[model samples]
Target: MNNEVNGDGPDSCGIRILGETRDLTVVNNRIGNAPKGQQHIGILIGEKSDRIELRENELSGNLDRKIEDRREEKLWPVQIRR
Candidate 1:
């Protein structure tokens, strides 16, 4: 699937696909910023998903309140591969 978010305002996420039951592919997307008053993420991949690939995309400016969350642990201004 193709996911993209382009704006100055904060957004919850560019794409959030939870409980995906099949193989998935995410390519050429841009995710950034979190909502106001609440810390959110640019992209969130739940534990239920498997065989997922994130390629040729941009993720930045994620505001995560919870330091323990995985989204909070990232290398900003660059692509993170897992």
Candidate 2:
């Protein structure tokens, strides 16, 4: 919580939840907005991740989609899911 993230890469993101990550919570953060011409994403939930929560986050000015969940079976958020 209370973080501001920025990165530069083809797959760069403000926050990235990858691999077998589970039972996690992300809240009250500001994500994305890389320098001009940089590829930046706000939140990236990877394919194998699960049981994650994102709450009250502010995502803006990303080069791509604000939040990208690449899970084959998408889940909803009373909290959030990968």
Candidate 3:
């Protein structure tokens, strides 16, 4: 599946994960566009989220952030493997 979000505001992204999400896995996906002065985000992992796995995914050209994590945990709970 293809996910796309076009906005020039905060929290605008291809994928937005909020609240208490755990044990989530994203694999083999193409996210966002190649930056050409456009502000975009590949994914937004918000507060109270944990244990997210990103594997074999192509996230490119997000001028803002490829992965933005806003969790309040002491340690980052994202595992990325490519």
Q: Using lDDT as the measure, what is the rank order of every candidate, best first?
A: 3, 2, 1
Top-scoring candidate (TM-score)? 3
Residue pairs clashing in model 1 are none
Worst 10 residues of 2 by lDDT: 1-10
Which pairs, if any, clash in model 3? 35-61
Q: Over the stretch 3-77, how does candidate 2's per-residue lDDT look in tens digits? A: 343446667777788998887899887665745546467778898887778888877764577777888876644
Looking at model 3, residue 6 earns an lDDT score of 64
- On lDDT, the candidate that comes out on top is 3
Off by over 4 Å in 2: 1-7, 75-82
Q: Against the true structure, what is each candidate's TM-score?
A: 0.52, 0.73, 0.78
For every model in order, what is the number of clashing pairs? 0, 0, 1
For 1-82, candidate 3 gives per-residue lDDT tens digits of: 2344466675567778887888899999888765443446778888888889999988776447899888877365699999
Model 3, which residues run further than 4 Å from truth?
A: 1-3, 34-39, 74-76
**Candidate 1 weakest lDDT stretch, 10 residues:** 65-74
Per-model C-alpha lDDT, please? 0.47, 0.70, 0.75
